[model samples]
Target: MAFCPICNGFEEIKIACSSCGNALMDNGRIMDYYDDYSPYMPIDQMKMEDGYPADYENRECPHLLKCAVCGMNVVRLIKE
Candidate 1:
């Protein structure tokens, strides 16, 4: 099975906000924000319906990162 380092807490992403240059906070997987029940579903299953057709096939985990200073939101794809 494919696994995500960030999601599993095995690693961390350090990215600067393009607008404010501040640190971006990881807000977990983007799939979780789809609905209330999305967080409770299986990871691979959710990836299939996460709007990105290649996420499941590529085993990539999409994470939502936000900048508190500029309120900038970004979607980063992490290879699993």
Candidate 2:
């Protein structure tokens, strides 16, 4: 699940930068950065693919959120 900087919960939450208090935008799925790849790949397939790493998970997609004003991270959706 995604979360706002303020800790609000939702599947697609809005967020803001903690330092600058600027609105954060959804930059799209983190997998978009991987050229010739799909986020929808099965877990087993993802593990076998090169460059994806062995620990890839849904919550660790840092590229999914970005601060629109400062270009910093604002969303706190990663599950600990």
Candidate 3:
């Protein structure tokens, strides 16, 4: 996990991308997984060389990060 270059606060924030404080509008609303309203493309397990979703069911998901320096929320492209 990456840290904020400035305050280093919210290091374990839900968003995978770094963020700035300003982007945070309210509490408990940082654009979580269920927020993704886009179409879902199923992942093919057979083609995966390695067993995907390692401990997925139990693993905690990553969330967005707010930048302490610029105070803007950033987005991250997640990989499976």
Candidate 4:
């Protein structure tokens, strides 16, 4: 779940969207979901002793970054 910056309400949300009655933003322009996220785990140093591959993959995000795939407004670093 994420918090709405305007109303400060908690709700499930998406990374891309627009608001209908947003005071500052256009109705449905571009919104975001600020939730817990994480980058991929490094392959080299990881090990099964920690648990298992699936456990690592299913771990709650340690951090989250924006998708550079389309350039949505996010905090993630984009590398070329």
Best by lDDT: 1
Off by over 4 Å in 1: none
Q: Give the TM-score of candidate 3.
A: 0.24
lDDT of 1 by residue, 5-42 (tens): 99999999999999989999999999999999999999
Judging by TM-score against the true structure, name the best candidate: 1
Give the local distance difference test score of model 4.
0.26
lDDT of 2 by residue, 1-80 (tens): 33323223345555667768877777654544556656566533543452445324543433357776677853233431
TM-score each candidate: 0.95, 0.46, 0.24, 0.15
Model 2 steric clash pairs: none
- Predictions in order: lDDT: 0.94, 0.49, 0.32, 0.26
- Candidate 4, residues 1-80: lDDT per residue as tens digits? 32223233332224442233222211210111221221133322232223234433443211132333433332211111
Q: Assess candidate 2 and give its TM-score to the true structure.
A: 0.46
Q: What are the per-residue Cα lDDT tens digits for candidate 3 across 1-80?
A: 32222123334334322343244322221222333531132222211322334323333222344555566654332322
TM-score attained by model 1:
0.95
What are the per-model C-alpha RMSD values against the true structure?
0.7, 6.3, 10.9, 13.9
Residue 31 local lDDT, model 1: 93
> How many angstroms is residue 67 displaced in model 4 relative to the true structure, after the best TM-score fit?
4.2
Any runs in candidate 2 off by more than 4 Å, and if so which?
1-11, 39-63, 74-80
Worst 10 residues of 1 by lDDT: 44-53
